[model samples]
Structures are given as C-alpha cells and as structure tokens.
Target chain A: MSELLIATHGLTKVYRGGVTAVDHVDLEVRAGDVYGFLGANGSGKTTTVRMLLGLVLATEGGIELFGEAMPKAGASVLPRVGALVEGPGAYPHLSGRANLTLLDSTDGRRRRGDRRRRVGEVLEQVGLDPADRRPVRTYSLGMRQRLGLASALLRRPPLLVLDEPTNGLDPQGIREMRELLLSLNRAGTTIFLSSHLLAEIEQMSSRVGVLDRGRLVLQEDLATLQAPTGLVRVRTPDLSTALRLLDGQVVDRGEGHLVVRSPDAAALNAHLVARDVRVTELGPERRSLEEIVLAASESA
Target chain B: MIRVELVKLLTRPRTWITILALNALPTLVAVLLAVTDLGPRPGTGPPFLSAVLTDGTLFPLAALGIVLPLFLPVAVAVVGGDAIAGEVQSDTLRYLLVRPVSRLRLLVAKLVSVVVFVVLAVLAVAVVAYVEGRLLLGDAPATGVVSVSGSTLTQAEMTQRTGLAFVYVVLAMLGVAAIALFFSTLTDSAVGAALGTIGVLVASTVLLGLDAADAIKPYLMTRHWLAFVDLFRDPIRWGDVVDGVLTQLGYLVVFAGAAWANFATKDVNR
Candidate 1:
C-alpha cells in the first residue's frame, strides 16, 4: 500500500449560523493517486479544500497531510503542497510574470537569485508566454487560469490541490490542461482535483469521492466503480430470434437490443450465432462514473 | 516577507497617487500665501503659518500643521485600512497564507508597510513644502528663526526641532495606522474599514471639543496630535510632546495587538 498523503478523520464544519457545510467525512488519498473530488454546487467541496489547506478552521475532527497534523504543521507542510482555490487571483495591475515573482518571494526558503528563472519555467510549463507584459486585468479567462496553475506549480510541490482547474478554458485549453496534469501525475505529483464535471473526473481520476449535501456519499476506485455488471448487451436485426434463444436470460429489451443476464458476452454471442441468429454487436454491460455518482447521491 | 510587502507598497501606483494628493493642499496653501501675502492672524490659523510669510525655512512646519489634523490622518487611515482587507478583497490573502507565510509574520509585514507609507507621505510633504517655501515665500533672516516663545533660534537649533517634529508627526500618524489596521482585519471591505477608522477619529475629535468629555480628554487619540507645536518653543515645552508620544505609542501597542489577535484566528472564508 502506498503511503497516505492526505487523511481526514471524521472531519466536519459548522458555520456560525449552524449550517453544516461539511459533515463527518473520512477522506484518504494515498501517494501518487489522482483523487477526484466530486460534488454539486454548494456541496462543501471548496470548504473542505480550504480546511485541508488551513484557510478555514475545522469545527470538529482532524486532518493529517504527509503524516503530520494540519493548520498546526501548516507552516512546514504547506510549502510542499501547492493549491489553486476557486479561481485565479492576482493584482490586477501587474503582469502575470510579475505576479508570480511576487508570490514566489513570499516563501523565504526560495533563493532570490532563482526566482526569475523559476517563474519563467512555470509560466512556460502552463503554456503561457513569459514575455507577455500586459497586466492581468487584460488577460483572458483561459490565460488567467493558466497563470493560476503556473503559480501553483512554481515550487514544483509534491502535491497539487486544484478546484475547477479547467474552468474558463476553451476545448483546446482544457485538453492541454488535462495532458499537462497527466504528465505531472506521471512525474510523481499527487493531485486532489475538485470539480462538478463528471467527464473530467472520469477521464483522469484513479480514485473518486463524491460529496452530496455536506456528506461523503461515495468513495471508491474508478476502476471498481466502473467494473462490468455481469450482464451482456446484444444488438441484432433478428431480435426476436435472439430473445427466443436466450429465453429467460433476457433481463431488458430495447428497440434493437437486449440485455441478457450472462457473465460471458462472447459465449452468449457464440450460442446465438450457432442457432442461426446474426449478432450485430455483443458486449458486457458496465456502469459509467455518472451512473455510479447519481446512484450514490440518490441513496444518500 | 517584510521586503515583499515593502516592494508591494512601493510599486503600487495608488501609493504615489495618494502621496501626491496629500502634498496638494500644502502646496496650494503656500502658493496662496506667497501670492496674496495674507497670512492668518498670528496664532489663529495653522501653527507657524503666519511665521512662514517671514521665514520660508519654517514652511515645512506650516505645511505639516496644515495637513496634520485631517489630510494626513485620512491618508494613513486609507492605506492602513486597506492593508489586510484589500488582500481579502483581491482574493490574494489565501494564496499568501498557503505560501506558508505565518499569520503573525504577514501581519507584522503589513504594519511595517503601512509605517513605510506614512513615513514616505510625511517626507514628501516636508520636502515639497521646503522647496515651495524657498522659491515662492520669504527668505529666512540671516540671524535665525524666531521661536514660538518670541526668542531667536539658531539655524542648527531650528533644524533639530524640525526633524523632531517630523518624527513626532510620523509617530502620531502611526496611531491612526494601528487603528485602521485593527479595523481592516475585522472586515473584508477595504472601503468599510477606512470609513470605520475615519468614524473613530471623528468621534474622538467631537468629544475633544465637548466640556462634558473632559475627564477622558487627555486619553483621546486625537487630543495630543498637535502637541508637536511645542517642539518649536524657546525652552522646548516637553510636557505635551512627551504625553503625545506616549499616548500615540499606547494606541499603537493596544490596537496592533488587537489586530493580531483577531486576525490570527480569522476563518478567512473569502
């Protein structure tokens, strides 16, 4: 088992007006895992991220990052973790390069001489032009998003916590961002990504956790959640003949397809073909991430 | 962190614009005094105003007097009030905190930046006023400046006292900065914090004029603000000057501590 990079035990948060933003959620993310955090609007994903980063104080329970208690060991632990919460924020009058340099200067451990170089490197890493001198106020939303990612990657941190990282990006920019994140993950950076876009999470996440109305409704590996359902889906012109041959094994029927309660799709296809039934398509039925999340939320 | 904060303060265009606005009033006063030669009746207007018509060297003091009561304090309140709250408003406070900058260090850096701004504004006013006084107003007599006590003060003595007054003015403005900073940490709106600090100063000024508030008058934040005038007296009246310094320091310690205590534990949801 890989070491747990982030662990929260019975974590909860209650606002001053008695609104529970995050209920008892025990989240665990191991090293090298691309953990996708999923939730609807106002489902406490951002609040939980803030707590993990020590921006918001937790009302109950505890959080441990890299094996040390958080918001207490934050001074030491945070330097190793990079984050972009909500969206990009920069001084409106400063160029993106200048903003990154200023933010880098806040960390005393970074050498002064290396700041400019590091800032340039991160800007290029995020597909931004380091020579662009326009103030951030004039930047397009996609440019600002890239700048935000550049800032988070400035120090080459071991972990990245990004909320809606791909927001405000065009299709091309989103694909670029996805590729960049995948490359970074392959290079050994743990990522905790929070978004409402299931497709984004489905494409990249190794493990997934879904939050619904202040509760962790689901937490499982993506592969496990998307595993085959021990049923076969067949599409054919001879639907009646296939159904008669399969008889009681047919669980569901559509216009030109049938869902058969069989574990082996190929064997079912062979049985139908030997009986003079032409099979157009045959495959095992499996759930998508969306279906799993919807079921989990409904059950919760 | 202090260096970074100072860099931020110095690089901002608003800082320079505010200092320019601060020097405007004093410069206008100098130009008007030079053109019309109508100085306020002795002791009736800003301290040393009537005297500056005769000795240009004394215009720095006159300029300080002109802006000390309202303009300088307002500028200080705006800058200090924006210290923390502006970060919150701009959404940069969380990024800074997660940079692993400790809360106490960030607060200290913010206070230092505000102090630097106060010093810069005060210095700019004094320097600009000196040039304006020399070029546009009467030249000082070869003998020396006449003290507030109607005694002659040597040039060296006058320079020393002017420097002392500059330091005192900076210290006085620090009291305002501390209060504004304390209020800044309490709200996410920079404008609201600035207005709240101004409100406190206005209340203090109102109570200072009321006889019914006499018992607490000595401790009022603005009560000792103009006591720097005593720095130019013949024998140098130290009573009010000392009290003023101590009072401003008292305000600084109390309000800065309050700001730190409140901000260190803030939820920072913004």
Candidate 2:
C-alpha cells in the first residue's frame, strides 16, 4: 500500500458556545490517492480540512502530513503541500499573473525565468490563457476558480487539498477539473477534496469519507461505498398489507411502492402473494450516493 | 521574500497612486503659498515660509495625523488586515498555511512590506518638503528655533536644526505607522484597519490636548509625537527627542506584540 500521506487521529474541535464543530474524527489519506470528503452543510468537513492545514488549532487531536506531526510540522511540512480552501480568493485588483507571483521561496533568491515559466505552465494547465493579463475581478467565476487552481499548482507540491473545487464551474469546466485532477494524481500528487456534490465525488475519488454532525459516519473505499446496497423496490396492489407480510425489513412504504432490504426476493414475492397482494414489479433499487449518505447520516 | 512583496506591491495601481497623491498634496500647498506671495519679504525672511514650513510640517503632520489616522493604518491594515483575515476572507489562508511557510514568516513578510511603504511615504514627504522649502524660502537658511521660552540660535545652527527637525518628524510618523500596523491585525477589511487606527489616534490626540487632565496624558502615544519640533531649539534639547523616540519605541513594541499575539491566536477560519 502507498504511504498514508495525510492522517488525523481522533481530531476534535469546539467553537464558541461549546459547539462541537468536529469530534473525534479519524481520517487517513494515502499517497497518490484521490480521497473524497463528502458531507452535508454543517457536517464539519471544512473544519477537518482546516485542522489538517493548521489554519486553525485543533481542540484535541493530532494531524500528520507525510508521517510528520502537524501543525507543529511547521514550514517543513507545508512546503510539500498546496491547497485551495473555501473560495478562490485572489487579489481582485491584481492581474492573474500578479496574484500567482505573490509568494515564493523566502530567501529572495528566485530564478526569475523559472518562476515565470512555471506560472505559465500552471495557467495553461488550468485552461487559462497564458497571456491573459486582465485583473482577477474581470474574470468569471469559472476563470477565477481556474486561476486559484493555477496558484495552488505554482510550486508543484506533492499533496493538494481542495475544498469545493467545483463550487462555481459550468459542465465543461467541471469535466476539465476532473480530468486535471486525474492527471495530477497520475503524475504522483495526492489529492484530498471535499464537496457536497456526491456525483462528483463518485466520479473522481478512490476512497471516501462521509462526515455528519461533527462525526465520521462512514469511511470506505469508493467501490464499496458505491456498491449496490441491495435494496429491492416493490410495487404491489396492497402496499400496507404487503409490507406487513414481507419477511425483509421495510425501508419505505408509500402510495404505490415499497422498498425493503432483502436477498431472498423470490421468498418475499411468494409471501406477499399469499397475503392477497398482487405484486406488480420487484427489482433491486439502484441507490445513489445522495441516498446512501443521507441514510448513513440519519442513522448516525 | 522582499521581491515577492515588492512584486505584489508594485502590481497594485493603488499603491503608486496613493504615494503620488500624498507627495503632491504638500507641493500643491507650497505652490499656492508661493504664487499668492503669502510670506515675509525676501530680505526680511518670509513669514509665510516659516508659517508654511511649521504648519507644512504640522498640516502634513496633521495629514500624517489623518493618514496615520487612515492612510498608514489603511496601509498597515492592508498588510495586517489581510495578513490572516484576508486569507480567511479569500479562503486562501489554507493554501498558504499548508505550504512550508510558518505563520510567523508570513506575518513578518507582511509587516516588512508595510514598513517599506511607510518608509517610502516618509522619504517622499521629506524630499518634497525640502524642494518646497528651498523654492519658497530661497537657498538661505532660516534662523534658529523660536523657543517657547524665548531663545535664539545662529544661522549655522538653524540649518542643522531644520535638517534634524525633518528627521524627527519622519520618526514620529513611524509611531503612527506602528499603531496602524497593530490595528491591522485586528481586522481583515482595509477600511476597518485604517479607520480603527485613525480613531485611536484622534482619541490619543484629544487626551494629549486636555491640559489639566494629568491622569492619561503621559501614557498616550500622541503626547510625545510632536516632540520632534523641539529639534529646532538652539541648544537642541535632546531630552524631548530622546523621550519621543523612546515613547515611540515603547508603543511600537507594545502595539506590535499585541497584534502578533492576537493574530497568532486568531482562528483563520474567520
């Protein structure tokens, strides 16, 4: 297995009013892995990322980046990491290129040509025109997002953390982002991303963690999380009586449909028919990530 | 590190425009006084030049008061204001913090940049004032400091006094710069940093002005801010300048430390 590039052990955070913003969350992200952090609004995803970055102090817990303790890791760990948090905050009054040029190696020693060349490369990678000199304020939301990504890529760090990277992108922009992330991972960069968009997570992530009410409700490989939950949707003439007669646990009993968790579909059908309920159809329900996540959160 | 900050500073048009306007304001005042022939006759030494220089120092010092009240603080605010708050507001603090750089380095880089600008503004004022003083008062030097206690100095002493007076004024401005910088750490909005700095300065000035109110006078930063004017005295009472520099240093250290501590502890998530 690849090394765990980023890890958080029993992380907890409490804001003013003793609100548990994050509570005892354990997260492990492996190198070269695209880890998807999925959570609803107010689920502590951002809080977790902030802790990992050392932007905010953790109330209790430790975080490790590349096997070294953080944020005590200091400048030693950050040099190898790049991130785009919350929104794409660029210097609105500055040109796109100017924004990217604001941070560099601290010793005032820079190969000017190399810096310029790298900036051009990242801009092109993000699909921004290399020569575009317009102030960032003039750029559209998608363009600004691209500029932000360009800034993150400037130093070519090994690990990249992005929060809601697709928050303000069109369909084409989203596709480009997905492809770009895949390419980055292939190039040996580990990516940890958080998003409320489940479909996007499903499409990009190798592993996923779901946070709910400041707790990690679920963490699993993408394949397992996306696997068919084996929920059977049943439509019967007498839904209420049919649900009562069914051997499986009833998940949903509505006007014309019923959903149940059961492997023995044939046994369920036979039992339902014997109860004078005419079964119209019965098949496995294809659960979307949205449904599974909501169920997990509710259960937690 | 300086280059990165310089690039950031130079790229923003507002930086140049602000410096330009500030430099020009005094020149404009000087030109108006010269054109209106608003001074003592040439052989008699221009009353207008002395009045102009004293108040030029005072007005710009007042403008310095305003600028410190707003401009330097705004500048300091922009630096400290954006220090972490800007990152938080822009959501880029995460990216910057995650990099190999420490919070202290980042804060130091920003503070250094603001100091550079403050230095720039002070130098610009000194140069413009020199040119205006020369043009309005002629190449000859003014008399010694007109002592509040009624004493006079020779011409040679007067020249030294004027030069030293300008230096003290710049030093006094540094006190204002430090205050603005300290306030900048408290807010993200440049406006908040600027306005808060000015508000504090105006209050300090008020406290300093209250003659009989002995309680708060000694502690106020404004109390000794004008002591640079004492450089004009014939004997050059080093006491006031020494006291002023020491007070300014004390405030710089105290305010700067307070800002750093608050910033180091502030949740960047804000």
Candidate 3:
C-alpha cells in the first residue's frame, strides 16, 4: 500500500569494459499505476529493470520496491512482485502446465492445493489450454510469450514487471497480451513493463517513462504526453518572409505548407499576420504519440 | 524451490536418457563377458571385471568401475554443468533468480539436484548390473570374497562393503560434480559448461601421468576416483579410501565455494 511501488535514486549500471548501460536514472512507479517504460533497443531500459529487480548489480545509486531498499530487500519484497524479463525463461522440455506448477512451488507463500488452481487459472487467463501437455520447446513464439505471462501471473502479486511482453507477438497475440495486461491493471496490480513499441505503450499505458541512450529522458502521464502537440500547418503567400520571421523557432517545412509547432496556434497566426504575411490556409494539427516520441529521441 | 529443481530435473527425457546411456557400457560389458567367457586376467581388463565373471554379486562392482572412470562421471559432469549454465543458456536464470530464493539458495537447490542425479545414476548402474550379472553370470552362495585378514566373510559383510564402496564412489564423483557446477556457474553456454567440466578432468587425468606430478597426484580430483576398489580389498584398505574421501571433500569445499562466490556476484544478463 505504499505510495510508490518502485523508486530509484540515481540508479546506474556500468558493465565491464567500461560500457555504461544505464546512467543515473531516477524513476518512480506509484501503486496501482500502469507505468510503461519506452525505449529503443539497447537503450538501457532492460538494464534499468534488471537493476531494479536485483538481477544486476548497480554501479551506483539505490532502488526501493514497496518502500524497502532493493537488492537487500529484494528477497523479501520479490515474492510480492511477479516478473517476466526478456526471455520465456522456461524449461523447454516441460509442458506449459508443468512449467507454471514448478515455478509456483517456489513461492513460500503459495498454499497447499492453491498451486494447482492458481496455475490452472493463470493458464486459462493467458489463453493457454489448461490440459495441454506439450512441451514448451514445441510451442510457437506467441505461445511461449503467453506462457511467460502466465508465469508472471502465477502469484497474482500486487506488482507485475514485464520486459517487452509483446516483443515477438503477432498482431492478434499482441492485442491479446495488451488486453490481458489492461485487465490485470484494472484488477489493481500495478504493472511496470518496458517495450520498444511506442504505439502499444501509448494505447496501454496510463503513464510512461522514456529512456534514450542510457538516461531517462522523460517521464509523464500518457494524457499529458498525448496532449495536442500544438502543431499548426500554415501556408502563406510570402513563404520566404514567413520562414524568416519564424527563424530561431521550431518549424518543419513541407512541400506546400510550413509546419509550425507551438503551444498556442492563435498567437503564431497573429504574429504572422502582424508581420504582413498573408496566410492562405492555417489549421492546427495534432501530433501522434509516435511522432512526439520520435522527435524527443531524435533530439536526444 | 528444491522441489521445483527436482521436478524440472525429473520431467526431462534427457535425465532418464543420460542414466540409460551411462548404464549402456556396463550392460554391454556384461553381455560381452557372459558370451565370450574370455576371462580378462585379474588387473587386466576392468578393476572388478574378473570378479564379475565369477561372482554375480561383483557385477555391480564391475559396473561401478566401468562408469566411475568415464561413463557415470561424464553424466555427472553433464548434469552438474547444466545446473545453472543450462538455465543461463535458455535465459531461465533470470526467472529463477527473481523468485524469493537467494542466489546461494538456488545454487544449493541445483547442487542438491545434481547430487540426486549422481546417486540415481550410480544406483541405476548398480541395479541393472546386479540384474544382468545375476541372470547371466549367476550369483554366489552367501559366501563373500576373501579378506586381507585371510578370512572369508559372510553375505552381510560383502553387502556392507558394497554399500560403503558405492557411497565412496558417489563422494568421489562429488568432486567432479562440484567442478562441473563451478564451471556451470562460470559460463552461459551449457555445452561449454559440460565440455569444460570434462575438459578439466581430462587434463587432470593427463597430469596424473607426468612423473613431475607425483607430489600433486594425490590431490588431483581424478586420483582417488577408483578408491572404491580399496573397499573390495581384503581387510578393507581404508588408507587410500580415506585419503580419496578427504581429497574429494577438499575439492568439493574449494570448488563449491568458488561456484558460490562467482554466482553470488554474477550479473544475470542472459
């Protein structure tokens, strides 16, 4: 019930050979929030998650889960956090049901007889057949992903941390995973996941944190980030003069229209009008989430 | 968590396959010896083959000898090396370690599982060899082998020696298992871990051949592997057997410790 389910102070990780995977990242995920971590491949997103989970040692800084200091408290705190990081991490020779049962038995809090029911429930929830006895090695990429999700849900923990839960899923599989995650979040599990799929994050996340290179560049609610990007597509009779007057400002020039982005489109139009530039067509345009993210990453 | 480790170990067809394959050599030896009747004079063929030809009870002993030098130990190496390395290769260590269990605790579970595997493998060799020997070569009258004290022992004494001898073999292989587990913790490649474990043993065996290694030979993990032979000797020569036990214990301690320290500090990037 802590305010922040996860918090980090100056968290950093430097691998051998002097490669810094994560650099002084300070992050917070409040309780009951679906926090999406977005980054390009090899953008230190996985490394940050690993550090938070105590799977990787941090070169500097500290982390806390449920108000307890990490690594030190990870053992005590981990049973309350379910996770699927990067790989299926499943025993290929065991059936899907067998895999979940085996993993569930590891939890100290797992009750007698509750294990089978929990495993069965998770299997059904993940859309896998409860009675399927096929080994995991024979499963398709999507099935393996579902199995991974099933393992994370085995405990029904308060927090579910997944890394690229939709990495290799097909369109339908992706949608299923998205809906499953949304439902889990709705049921009060604070979900923290990382993915390179910006649009997926935009659709599924209530809040998002962006990682570029090795640093956390931006963290904001999707509502705030999805705000009308204040982009205005304007065409003027004197295009050259409009360009001059708009110097030192952010602008994108298209074939016919000059794209100007600002918080207020009316003010931009008034300034252009005062400059004696006869505007032909002016309309406010909103930027998509992908475009906004692309802009941020490009500038980084 | 240990239960999880056991279930995982048991459900794999590879586990039973490894055990069956390990028993293959002894089974082959039994069938060949029974048919050919070509008695490989004492100390010539295998350590206990001559006895196996005469006494069905000794067939299990002969099987142990065949496997101890190569077969069973290799299986142990495979299983032990695959302990964490297999998980790492499959990227399952990330999931396993994220549970409530600590790295050391997981390592212990894995080590215990490997030990259970070794015990099962050794016992398989013994049981199958016993049945094969009993059916093909035939058992002896409750009489036992002659003791160094120059006295023939009873069935009880022989059975006791057999049990002690098997236990000693398990301990000896614990050295190899620990070594393999250490390498398993060191690498993410399961094949490399298994091969690396076997590679070190092979190198040590090769070293035991050099005249310069005489002083260190006694300390080699491979040196005391056949000490189980001493248990079969008259008067039960405890000297070499005890030394082997101590040497194996020493290796297990050092190597198990090394595996622990390395695994504890390792970053589970895979």
Candidate 4:
C-alpha cells in the first residue's frame, strides 16, 4: 500500500443539546487500500466522514489529507477527492447526462468530445447505459446508487469516500458495486467505504475499523480479524454454575446460555464435569464474519 | 454536468411555478377589470372603457398605483424567500456541499439564480399588463363620465406617469426580493421563509399607515414602496426616485452581504 492517504487525530463533533456524536476519533487510511469504516447507525461513522469532507465542522483536532495538514477544505486538496456523502445528489428534473454536464463544467474541464466520452466511460463503469437520458427521479434505488457512483467517478479522483454506496441494492447490484470498487482500488485510488454491513466489507476491504458508540474499538486487516476459530456451546443441567466457573471465558448468549471458544473440547468437558455440570450438547460452532462482528460489537 | 449547485436550484419546480403564477396574476386581474364594468361611470361618461382605458386612467392601475406597490414585490418575495432554506429541508444541500465546490460559490450561484427568476417574473407582469392595457383601451377619447377630479392629469400626462410608475415599481420589487432572499438564508423551511417575507412586507405597510408614526415612516421600506406615487404628480420629482433607488440598493447590499456570510459559515449538514 502507498503512504497514508488520510490521517486524523482527535477528531470530534458535538451537536446541539449536548450530544457528542463523534468523540476524538483518530483514523489512518493508506493510498490504494480499500478501508472499510464499520459502525451501526448514529455511531459516529457518518459524522467522522462529514468532518473529513468539510461538510460538518469538526469540534476539535487535526486532519491531514495526502500528507498536508487540512485545517479546512482547500482547493489544492478538494478537487482531487471525490465523495458521495449520503446518497444521490443529482437533480431529479435533469437527465443523467445533464447532471454529469453540470459537475464537469464546475471544474472547467470542458470539451464536447471529452464530455460525451467521459460520461460514456463513467456510465459504463457504473453499469448504467449512457444512451438513456431519463431524469434521475425515475431511476430505481440501485440505479440511483449507480448514478451517484458515476458522478463521483467523473473526475477519476484519487481518493474516493462513499458512504453506504451499496445501500438498498439487490444482490446483483451489490456484487457489481463490490467489483467496481475493487477495480477502482486496483487502479491506485484509495477507497474509504463506511457501512454497517460487515459481510460486504469483509469481502471487499483490505482492512476494517469497528466503531461502537462514538469510539473505535478495533482496527485490523480483514484476514487477520476473520481467522477461523471454533466456538463451543455446551448445554448443562445447571446454567448459572457453569457460567460462574468459566467467568472470563464465556460470551453471554442470553436465555441461560453461554458461548465459549476453545481449541480443546475434551479438556473443556472434563473441567465442566468436575464442576458437576452435565454436558447435554457439545459441538463445534462455525464462526462466520457476522458472528465475529456481533461478538466484537457485544464486547464493545 | 452543470454545477451541482445550479441543479439544486432547479430541482424545486414549485419555486418557479409559484413565481410564474404570482407574476401572471396581477396582469390577469387587470385585464379582467379592463373588460368589465364593475364601478360606476363618472358623470354618465361614454361607458367605462372610454373613461378608464382611453383617457389613460389605466396607467396608474396597471403600473404604479396598485400593481407595483402590492403585487410585484410580493411575487418577487414568494420565490426568492425560499432559495437557501428550502435546500436544507429537502436534504439535498448536503450532497452539493460534499462535491468539490466551496460554500461561497454555491451561495453565489443559487442567489444569482433566485435574483434572475425574480427579475424575469417582474418583467413578465409589467409587459403583460402594458400590452393588455394598450389593446383594451386604444385611441378612444375620454368622455365626461369618469370622475376626472381636478387632480386628474391630461391624457398625454397620464401616459408619461404610467411609464415612470413602472420604473419605481421595479426598484421597490427589487428591494422586496432582496429582503425575502435574506430571510431565506435564516431558515430551513420554505413556508417560514415565504410567509416571514410577506409578513414583514405587510407589517411595514401597516407601519406606514399609522398617522402618529409619520416621523419613522420615511425610513421604513414600505413607505418608500410607494415612492412610485411621486411619478404621478406633475413636473415629476426626481428626488424621491433617486432616494428610492439608493434605499433599495442599500437594502439589497445589506441583505446580500448577510446571506453570503451566513451561508459561507453555516454548517450545511442537511
């Protein structure tokens, strides 16, 4: 991966009425790496993204983009960064082509042939047909997502920040978006994707950061974080006593059940037997990305 | 792609539609009035048409006396008042800001578009009213029916009066539109901005009506709203016209300056 493309230290945002949505978040995203920012709704992921793009004012701290300190948005830095902060921002009354024309003209990158050519390229990249000139309001949710993606790709920006780009997409559209993002990353563009869907992030991102309640709990590569490990669920006659004995080794699974992870099952059974807890059911549990994420979230 | 900011401006179809209706209504009403014989004829004057249209009385009703003072500026406000705040409500403002454009440029583009719409709407009202007046009342000589109070001017004088009235109305309308645009910056609800603008205009008009408050009337925006009234008198007074232009210009500068500052600094999270 290239050097750090984005770095922030002590970033914070406090809304009115004393709600501290984002609390002193520090993040580092390297160039050409697909970094997934994971968090549930209202967990400060969106707030941090907004601060980085200068859409919302940061309460405190420093942000550096591509090696330069960013006290505020600057012309030198912003033009090279493309983002879809929330959702589709295009005009509903204008056709998809007209929307692209407006964005292209603002940057003074104009040429009749270039406009048509670039629009075609971006439409193809986003899986939208350039020949269709219907207003964006008529597009489906997935199509709007594609249109937004096309807008972001118009400039072929080096740093692309997309928040929930695959939101509301069908399985096919989601797969296409995943592939498109990977292709963009392969071409040396750093991708910063914020989403609540860990499965999608697990499939696409090189690294993932888990945020819970306005705080970062863990930041690790997807491969390292998803290492397969067996989870052992043993049902006993006495649930309360089993949990008491294996205090630090148990994840609360409500309704008088506990999930314990261990490599040796025989040894676990012997220990439980010694405590007079009957093991009714003992089996190896498969650990999926969803379980791991849930465990991490529950632990946080 | 046209700039995202401009696209945002055009997305609200209701804004311009409201402006179109507001501008067209005054002319429509005037035309309807011209064709009808609602009021009594003066001194059994040859029918209502000869007294009102042919004698040039339609000039005051069409341009200065009523249409410009009440309707034109209010129409301008109806559109310009919702320019900024409407975006906040629709949540599209966030999308535009995320694009590479600065807040200042975005505000400038949106403000210019709103001003352009207001100007165009005002002009439409003026043209339609003028053409309709001329067609309905062409060349017929004035009879003794309509009250040509001693205060009434000659036919030629009335035509000049109408022309000057149009200029003053334009100036007053410009001031109203600027105020409305400023209020739009202060709020997120389109209704709040539009109603607040109209309410302020109405309040100023009421302020001008108070006999005891005459001293403060000269400084009020509403008092100067009828500065076009000066155009109706003989030997047209350029002093009120100049003061009216300068005052409207001053208000425009202040309102526009505040809008720029607020939009540039305010957080557009939407």
Best by DockQ: 1
Worst 10 residues of 1 chain A by lDDT: A127-136
Q: Report clash pairs, candidate 4.
A: A100-B1, A101-B1, A101-B2, A102-B1, A102-B2, A102-B3, A103-B1, B42-B145, B42-B146, B45-B145
lDDT of 4 by residue, A1-300 (tens): 559888989888888888988887888898877999999998988888888877778878888888776636455677777787777766677777777776676765446568888888898888888534898778887888888888888888999989999987899999989988898889888999999887888888888887888877777777776654556777776888988888888864656566887777778889999989988886656666677667887887
Model 1 CA lDDT for position A242: 87
Docking quality category of candidate 1 according to DockQ thresholds: high
Of 1 and 2, the candidate ranking higher by TM-score: 1
Deviation (Å) of A228 in candidate 3: 3.1
Residue-pair clashes per candidate? 0, 10, 2, 10
How do the residues B1-270 of candidate 4 rate in per-residue lDDT, one tens digit apiece? 224444555566765676556546545555665667343354352222334445444533444344455665666676677666766664456655665566777666766676666555556656655566666544455532222333656667765655666656666666676777778878888778878888888888888889988887766776666556566545566687778788778877887788787777676565
- For model 3 the TM-score comes to 0.90
Q: What TM-score does chain A of each model score against the native chain A?
A: 0.97, 0.80, 0.81, 0.78
Best model per lDDT? 1
User: What is candidate 2's local distance difference test score?
Assistant: 0.72
RMSD of each: 1.1, 6.0, 4.5, 7.2
Worst window of 10 by summed lDDT in candidate 3 chain B: B141-150
Per-candidate TM vs. native?
A: 0.98, 0.82, 0.90, 0.80
Candidate 1 structure quality by residue, lDDT tens digits, B164-246 = 99999999987899999999999999999999999999999999999999999999999999999999898999999999989
Q: Is candidate 1 or candidate 2 better by lDDT?
A: 1
Model 1: CA > 4 A from native: none
Pairing residues by index, what is the TM-score of model 2? 0.82
When 1 and 3 are scored with DockQ, the better candidate is 1
Could you give candidate 2's per-residue lDDT for residues A102-123 as a string of tens digits? 6544424456668778877888
Off by over 4 Å in 2: A105-113, A228-286, B40-92, B134-163
